[model samples]
Target: MNGRRTIGFLLLIGLVLWGCSGVHPTSNAVWIAQPEFSEVDNRLYSARIAPQKGESPYFSFFLLTLTNKSSVDLVVDWNASQYLFNGKPQGVMVFEGIDPEAVKNAMVPLDTVAPGASFSLEIMPMRLIAWSPIKEKTAAARSISPGMLPIGENGILLALRHGNGHITIPLSVRISREGLP
Candidate 1:
């Protein structure tokens, strides 16, 4: 009986350690979902933070998918929006393409989506990214570096506007990773 009890205790401890890791086993991107404020609709407009795929070694971006389930136009107010990282205010920039040198500290303008349409935006933390130029062989290239936030709970707060007032969506995620991969 004592031997069986000892084995059970070991198994319990192992399971606890595994749970503490808190990482997605299969997919590359994993965000701990927020039960509230994740998905909201201002009568006719709706928005949600879609899952991000294809994470880079120096990861610093979020893919947000917005849908207009109503029959009218909606606008994503970037001016009234904010990025929430680790429960703090973070500046963000939305842009197209994957060029590292092209990304700047400027935020993307407001998005006006037609009725019954869906779209996605690739957003990155402005201050969380660092740029450096390096010359190799005979050419100079720029590299986008990651911030100190390698592991923690981080997310973004989005603002959507219409003819009336506006609605806010807050997405929080739990991040776990090795330091600076």
Candidate 2:
């Protein structure tokens, strides 16, 4: 049953990955990321990607505005890649844990962003995911557990401290055709 489920999941991912082909060639390769919040319903916060009007084949970063709806303070540990294709989450990329230097360089501290407070996280182009052909060993790993591998055409994952357990976020991703770029 577990094997079946895994196969099913892989098939689903394949289908979504294949869906990219439906993307018209004339359709600008512009990225469209829409974040669907995981509803916990306790004074939830929100974030979104705002597409900028500009030239083609250009990288526009993920512009997120986090809104604090609850009265109490919500502490969001900063170590997750919140990228997804369309509304379906691609799965979280778990890094080697949060490094202060990485956070200092790549992320901005919320510093206890109070309730009803709003803060934005802007990920620039250079920081975004870049894709190239997978190496033989990495490709083999991807064939097994793409999630377990450190890097691939699928991009990077980050591990976040969630109580005792951890959550993963894909920091950067490159979805492409099976054979073509």
Candidate 2: segments with Cα more than 4 A from true spot: 1-42, 51-57, 80-100, 103-110, 124-181
Query: Candidate 1, 57: how far from true, in Å?
Result: 4.0
Model 1 per-residue lDDT tens digits across residues 59-140: 3566677878777777887655676768877765444333543334334467888888887876655566665544422234
Q: Considering summed lDDT, which 10 consecutive residues are worst modelled in model 2?
A: 142-151
TM-score list, all predictions: 0.57, 0.35
Best by lDDT: 1
Question: How far does residue 34 in candidate 1 sit from its true spot (Å)?
Answer: 8.9
Q: Using TM-score as the measure, which candidate wins?
A: 1
TM-score of 1: 0.57
- The alpha-carbon lDDT assigned to residue 172 of candidate 2 equals 34
